[model samples]
Target chain A: DQQVKQNSPSLSVQEGRISILNCDYTNSMFDYFLWYKKYPAEGPTFLISISSIKDKNEDGRFTVFLNKSAKHLSLHIVPSQPGDSAVYFCAASKRNYGQNFVFGPGTRLSVLP
Target chain B: DAGVTQSPTHLIKTRGQQVTLRCSPKSGHDTVSWYQQALGQGPQFIFQYYEEEERQRGNFPDRFSGHQFPNYSSELNVNALLLGDSALYLCASSLGEVNQPQHFGDGTRLSIL
Candidate 1:
């Protein structure tokens, strides 16, 4: 079973607009969430993360919102830029077991200039 | 200043053949985590090593094994490979192993022919 899932295989958005990516999980044990962006032939780069203790965390133009009870989380990028176009993966971790993580299929964000 | 580095940018293997993928964590980092990403799917965690010892493991089977050296470099080995083993193998490193965000390297694309 996939503990974490990103339902959208891809998302298309216009530049300078807000781009939102969503993710869901079935494991209540997960207490931390992270988002990573990957370019072709490259490893994923850390984007932003949020702890279960808080519902929202923001960094520059990126913000992550978590709904613990719903086991859902989303990442938002304001004023989407062309450089932001990439495959975004969502991952969850539970500290109970050395913070082991489960990742979801990524969503490819295509920004149209 | 160095990011995680992985070797053999790409590889082609046959069924039953063994392959070794290598990784060097970012400077000053001590923890290494391995993941496998199949096409159209999210990455699956294989395991994690800390202080030259495996600190955690995921659901992968015995065919998939790894070793970490004293310098925190790591190698992932796949034995008796199958066509299904084709995918991108990624290595990530973190500091302190506390669910801290991990830095990744450009993965090795392994194709089974």
Candidate 2:
């Protein structure tokens, strides 16, 4: 059973537009959430993260919003650039349990110039 | 600073063969984690090593094992490789802090025949 799910398999956005990627999880015990971006032949790069204590976290052009009650999170990239085209993965873990992260199927985002 | 580095960018093996992959963590990082990424899917955690010990592991079987050196580098060993083992193997490193983001390497692509 997949504990984390990214419903959208792919997304396309024009350069300078805003791109939004969504994720959902079934486990409520997950307290830390992270987003990673990956390019072909490269490992996923850590982008942004949000703890359950806060509803949102923003890093430069990337912002992640979490809704605890809904068990959903979204990553927003404003003024998306062509360089932003890549696969984005959402991962979650319980902070206190020292458990490994559970990652969702990634969403491929294509930024068209 | 040099980021996480993995060895043998690609490898090919047959069923029942054994393979070993190596990783050198980012500068000053003390923790290492391993993940497997299948085509069109996000990475799945295999295990983590800290202080030369296996701190946590995912649902992967005994066929997957790892070792961490005193220098903080790590190695992943897979025994009795099957076709299903074909995937991208990723290594991530981080500080032993409570909630630090992980830095990943380019990964080693393993193909099983």
Candidate 3:
């Protein structure tokens, strides 16, 4: 069974617009959530993360929000640029555990000019 | 400083053959984790090594094994490879600190023919 799920296969947004990606998990043990952006033929790059203790974490144009009660989290990018277009993956891991991250299927986001 | 580095960018093997992949962690990093990503899917954890020991492993089969050197580099060995073993193998490195972000390599693409 998949512990994490990203139902959206793809998303498209215009330049300078806002892009939102959502993810859900079934494992309650997960206390740390992360977002990664990947380009074709390259490894996923770490974007932002949020701990279960906080409802939101923001860094520059990127923001991550966690709703532990709903077992859901989302990533938001304001003033999205074409450079932001890529596959976005959501991953989760439990604290003090082995630090093995569980990733979702991913969502392809395209930011148009 | 160099980021996580992986060897043999690509490899091809037949059924029942054995293959080994190598990784060098980022500068000053002491932990390494291995993951497998299939086409159109996110990465799945295989195992993690720290202090020259296997600290944790995922649900992968015994056919998948690994080793960590005193220098903090790592190697992944797969025995009796099957067509299903074809995928992108990613190596991520991080500090031993909990909740630290991991840096990933471009990954080695393995093809089983």
Against the true structure, whose lDDT is highest? 3
Best DockQ goes to which candidate?
A: 3
Candidate 2 at B66: error in angstroms? 0.7
Task: Rank the models by lDDT, top first.
Answer: 3, 2, 1
Which stretches of model 1 miss by more than 4 angstroms? none
Predicted model with the maximum TM-score: 3
Instruction: Give a tens-digit lDDT track for model 1, residues B1-113.
Output: 99999999999999999999999999999889999999988788899999888889998889999999999999999999999999999999988656688888999999999
Error of 3 at B50 (Å): 0.5
lDDT of 2 by residue, A1-113 (tens): 99999999999999999999999999999999999999998889999999999999999999999999999999999989999999999999988756478999999999999
Q: Evaluated on chain B only, what are the TM-scores of all the candidate structures, in order?
A: 0.97, 0.99, 0.99
DockQ of each: 0.80, 0.76, 0.87
Q: For candidate 3, give the docking quality class from DockQ.
A: high
The digit string of per-residue lDDT tens for model 2 on B1-113 reads 99999999999999999999999999999999999999988899999999999999998999999999999999999999999999999999998876788889999999999
DockQ pick, better of 1 and 2: 1
Model 3 lDDT on a 0 to 1 scale: 0.96
Q: Rank the candidates by DockQ, best first.
A: 3, 1, 2
lDDT of 3 by residue, A1-113 (tens): 99999999999999999999999999999998999999998999999988888999999999999999899999999989999999999999999796889999999999999
Return whichever of 1 and 2 wins on TM-score.
Answer: 2
Docking quality (DockQ) of candidate 1 = 0.80
Pairs of residues clashing in candidate 1:
none
Better of 2 and 3 by DockQ: 3
